[model samples]
Target: MGVLSFLRATYDLDTLDTRFTNTSSTPYKTVIEARGDAAASKERAAKWKSQGQPSRWNTPEFYLYYFVLLLVIPYMFWVAYDASRPTDPKYKLYERLLRPGWIPGRKIDASDSQYNTFRSNIPYMAALLVLHPLLRRLYNAVVYPVKATGQGSRPTPEEADQRLNQRATFDFGFALVYLVALHGISAFKILLILYTNYQVATALPRKYVPAASWVFNIGILFANELCRGYKFGEMAALIAGPTVQNSVLDSGSTLVSWGRWLDSYGGLMGRWEILFNITVLRLMSFNLDYYWSLDRRSYSPVEKQIDPAALSERDRVSIPAQAKDFSFRNYVAYAIYAPLYLTGPVITFNDFISQQRYKAASIEPARTLRYAARFALCLLAMEIILHYDYVQAISKARPEWGRYTAAQLSVLSFFNLHLIWLKLLLPWRLFRLWALADGVDPPENMVRCVSDNWSTLAFWRSWHRSFYRWSLRYIYVPLGGSSFRTPRDAARSILTYVLVFTFVALWHDIQLRLLVWGWLVVFFMLPEMAAGFLFPKAKWEGRPTAYRMLCCLGAVVNIFMMMVANLVGFAVGVDGLENIIAGIFRDFSGFCFIISASMALFVGVQVMFEIRESEARRGINLKC
Candidate 1:
């Protein structure tokens, strides 16, 4: 009776027994507290997003090589076309460009021999690349601003301070570092190709070439890894050194030295660590996988997680146990295989070794050609999209992002985040084509990311799926994934996914913003997972129009939120991000329009594509 009265009074519930006339409205204090909390939580969530990370990415102007990639496609096409033309005007354009020719009448003349040598010089190209983006940035800052809004207004001290990278000097410094590292990576790539072509030859005796390639690659990478260890010496000195002199030691050393080591270490490593750390990580994966394969043990279907009903021996990617024998050579060679090294469909050692001896029959000529054409188009799309307005928006300082309409900022946010499609798409396809020609079946990295129907979880999983496979095999299943029935089991599963996101974030760039991005990813994804658990597809999904429509709405909102969070998370620094967050909240109406319009376009296109795809499938089935 007491419980009924309390419930009725507190919640204003209509009960069958209307004995208790406790129909008093919510208390003034309670209503005020709730409203305060609702407002406070929004502010709290925004600031909490930046806690303990005084930094944003705070990284360099990397990806200068993306410019090289942009130029390479056109060059490759020219080369192909140039090779085909057997006529008198053969290679005229390249010849003119290579030679010193400018403005028709007053044409600059040069010795062809001297000009050719200087023109093809790697240093010259690297310098040009390093300068191009920097110049463009400077031009935006000084000579010409892209948007009228950016040019018209002068910012306050706070606004100026909010700009993430206002230092052209720092950009130049990092651009130099970027160019140097790029040169190393390019050298590594060239060496790898030369090494692979030599190693994969039929004439080269088994074990010799792989061993030589291993030694060759490992030796190169080990040198870089050794240089990375130089920091440990600095670390030791920082840890060992005392503060406040010998007089302080009489009373025991001051504890001011506590964070000195870390500060020193960080000051020393700053941002160059990205270049060094990546090489070390790739080497670790390669070395570890090769070490495991030394014994060549074979397991039964159950142990290998092979279902009896799933695939025949012919259908599955199976290798003979004998084939798995670890040659230190194969390990090193596969680890540093140029195409797979940098942008990977992050393949495993065992799979890589197996592919080394792939049967020619498995590679259908027609299929490879089709795949090439389709992927070529994808590459073109990637290049075309790089020229997008959103790309330019992020390029310049946006400390005053608030001045732009929230819709403009939202478009910037959405596409800036989504342009990763090109980064992954361009490289993965180019590498995959070469890998395919080598008889290696590279798994798809991205599958329908844009058209993934706005499911946050699906988009995350679909993007870089090969890496997801690696995570599953190495991280997820090992942690007892997908068996969450109890609270403890559920925590384990969620923690495993959190680690997966962390790994992905850290893998891309070792930054807290990325870790937060990962957190946001898993947070957004969890609701869908919980919903799937509670409501089975047959019972709750696709049964009625309204339920399905609700699902679609949920999907759109999730995707929009995902894009917003990602953009802010990936913004240059905390202040730039702060401006964006503040801007969105200041004009919530404009944000809503941005979210709705962006989603309507994204989801609407996806829906139409899916419908067309479904119809095509049906037609194919009918024909069959």
Candidate 2:
């Protein structure tokens, strides 16, 4: 009996939590609403969350999936990696295709130009993380002690304000020092930009604040990009007057060398303007959040709880506290919080300032340690892939299309997209982990594996989830996005999506390709939206077989469109995608290949559906 009990306990035949209670206050409602879509509220998340999840191990389809993956994935990987080999028959034909500006004789890591900026600073980031706890303890000791007024008592309002002021001062001081070190003298220029924006936020009429903030920040962003962050050489030349400037500030002059050395010493981010896009978002978050917080009726000016840790993530993010917390000191500290300054799992002004007052539930130590481990593992995985697969190199080199089959180009484009995802994912995770260690719980950026996606809408939601949420709250909602509103208006939503993605494209970079990419994303989303509208599960659930079949087919189409859009946008660009498309239609063989691939995608979509069902059964509905 004892042995049987031990075996049963260890094995746990019931792998999933089948019991799903649907009470009003159950966490699932919050989860659904937090997704910020009215569609989710219409029993999508709720109904799914209540379903009993069966183990995939019990299903024959699972074995089929395993077999297919075993057969296909390895072949895909081999084809992708094998083509880059020097011994491959076509390698020499494309050897000269390597793009310029990279090392002439060496294989290029296209992502290295971007990723090395983060990788090279690993030492600095590591040292800062190590010293962070000690530094925090020091700050706590001097500014706001752990026991401010002895064990059980809290400090008086005056004392609390003074302590907080000291802490903010300390935060701003550290942020200033770090920024100056990172951007050299250009840090002042950054501060000035923020300061001027700050005045606009505070001084403008309530109605005008939003418009002014948007215009000023975006205008400055374009100006900065155009001027290349006010190059030190240009600045010196301008200061010197045209007559003497040409001779005095030649490329080889002492001043030129000095500027170059300073930039090198400061690391690659010395210009500060390069990272201004991210800073611009934070600036908007601050200014916009503050502008909204001004209306006393809508946003209660009361200090309900001096500590906002008790508030939910939703409330903490969307709601602002008393006006006092939105001071310039707090604003600057939040703007340049070193870990998130470069790339953000962007936290809003309210959330950032509030989290500083008290630790939130999200900052679990064991969880953070696990997260850190995951980040390290991801970094290792990226390194291994970079070492083995030169797909990025090959793609950037623009190898001869005539030398490769349609399948080869597809695999190259596919893996290149995966590499792009990993490249962004690894850095975002690293910075997020760093912020976690510092006890600031910014949102996770990449929520799903790039390949795990089957829906175009869901892909964007999972990719850069923080930014999505930021855009949803700040941009989409303001532009009258009907995701959360009642009586769903498709026209309004579509228009909002167009406007949002348009801004998104420009915000990413002042590039024409990105603008096209944004439009393509919106265009692709139309079919998915239309299908969801036509097949309201409530009306079609009686015919589960037909509904499931329809969904599976839709998923396949969604996946295809998603791939094309992403390939055109991020992986291959218009020219490369055009080449791939042309290759596919070049012969009868390519048509047969597409048919087989579509069948494979159908099977994969079924597995993806089951995976989501299994997650829902276990009360782990992500909706995305």
**Can you write out model 2's per-residue Cα lDDT over 1-624, one digit (the tens) per residue?**
476664443232111110112221232224434557776566665676568444565677668877887787888888877887778876665556433323344453434467656666778878887786568668878766643553433344445465556556777888888887778778878899989999999988788999999899889979998988776767666666788877877645677556555445444466678787888999999998888887753454235542333456666676675688888999998898877988887889988876676555556565566566566767777766665567777766666675677677777777878888988998788788778787777877876678788998889988988899899889988887666233467677878899999988888888888888999999999999878877888987588768878899999989889888888777778998887788776888888878877877888887788777766664565567
lDDT on C-alpha atoms for all candidate structures = 0.47, 0.74
TM-score of 2: 0.85
RMSD of every candidate to native, in Å, equals 27.1, 6.7
TM-score of each: 0.53, 0.85
What stretches of model 2 exceed 4 Å from their correct place? Answer: 1-57, 89-111, 142-146, 150-167, 236-268, 297-307, 483-489
Predicted candidate 2, C-alpha RMSD: 6.7
Clashes of each: 0, 1
lDDT of 1 at 449: 46
